[model samples]
Target: MSRTSRVLYLIVCASPRARRIGELVGRAQARGWTVCVIPTPQALKFIDRPTLEEQTGFPVRSEYKQWDITNPLPPPDAMLACPATCNTGNKWVYGLADTLALALLTEAIGLGLPLVVAPALNSAQAVYPAFDRSVTALREMGVTVLYGPGVYGPGPPGSGGRPYDWELPLEALQEKVVRPERRK
Candidate 1:
């Protein structure tokens, strides 16, 4: 039987805003996309790898193993770096690949695949020089960087401290992953 070819890579960062990664993953899967998550060590603290693995029915890789290339997983049709922390976003925009997510993202961009990033940072820090340069670099490299909405407080009121009704680049991701590629 042929398998459905929908695949997406989820890259999270170590930040308070990274909490939304799971919800985004769930929504993606419900849309018939197979998600492969690559979380940083810091992101793992916010989410559970086992839970992600079970939900996606794929391995949730945190590290790049040199010897694991015997069987390579198919490249995702698109990559969504959700809740892109201030640090991770800047690092990736400047072509820093110290982490597995950045490395894979670099390769994805090289292959001309769609890369959508949703940046999550406070107003004060988001306006920093490094952040500005990083955003510019990513745009120059054809990476779609979505600016976060201006929401104050811990999030939802009932949550006692959590971002509420923030903008996610879901439409952008759906546009890429669900669209059928045109054959030449």
Candidate 2:
């Protein structure tokens, strides 16, 4: 096992690709990384909550826990926001912590954690200048924003697009996360 003690938080958004996020969890676990799922409020409808809990052995959270309560999940070494919708991307860029997912992402950036974002949006939405600016800003802050043909390209005009590979985020995660062997 490699880095079994480490944690990876997979923040899901309200996109069709989010339904298949379980695949990423399995891949992360195979790499001996504990996977924690934190979906956006609207993302709750896209994921299989109980099944994910069964697979990861941790509750899937969509909101902040009650105050004064100890955190149930361990701190994450890295974070990936897959199926990150246009709204999520824009909000995150603006430092909007309206949802648990965005809040986690904002904090992760400030903490300098390895972060990856694979956004799913149509060509129409992706064309918005704000989207490009957001992506650039996130990348400038050391976040790996995966948004290309194979990762998260724009779809058709009106319809919301799907991601080429749901596993790309995990692939990005592997390449970016600091490994035990690389520790100073």
The prediction achieving the highest lDDT against the true structure is 2
Query: Which portions of model 2 show Cα errors greater than 4 Å?
Result: 1-4, 149-151, 157-163, 178-184
Q: 1-184 in candidate 2: lDDT tens per residue?
A: 2344679999999887878888878987888889899999899998999999999998998989888998888898989888789899999989999988899999998887888888888778888989999988888878888886655567785555343565677777777864523211
Error at 171, model 1, angstroms: 0.6
TM-score, every prediction: 0.81, 0.89
Which residue pairs clash in candidate 1?
A: 154-161, 154-162, 155-162, 155-163
Query: After best superposition, candidate 1 residue 47: deviation in angstroms?
Result: 0.6
How many clashes show up in model 2? 0
C-alpha positional error of residue 120 in candidate 2 after TM-score superposition, expressed in Å: 0.6
lDDT minimum window of 10 residues, candidate 2:
175-184
User: In candidate 2, residue 39 scores what lDDT?
Assistant: 96
TM-score of the candidate numbered 1? Answer: 0.81
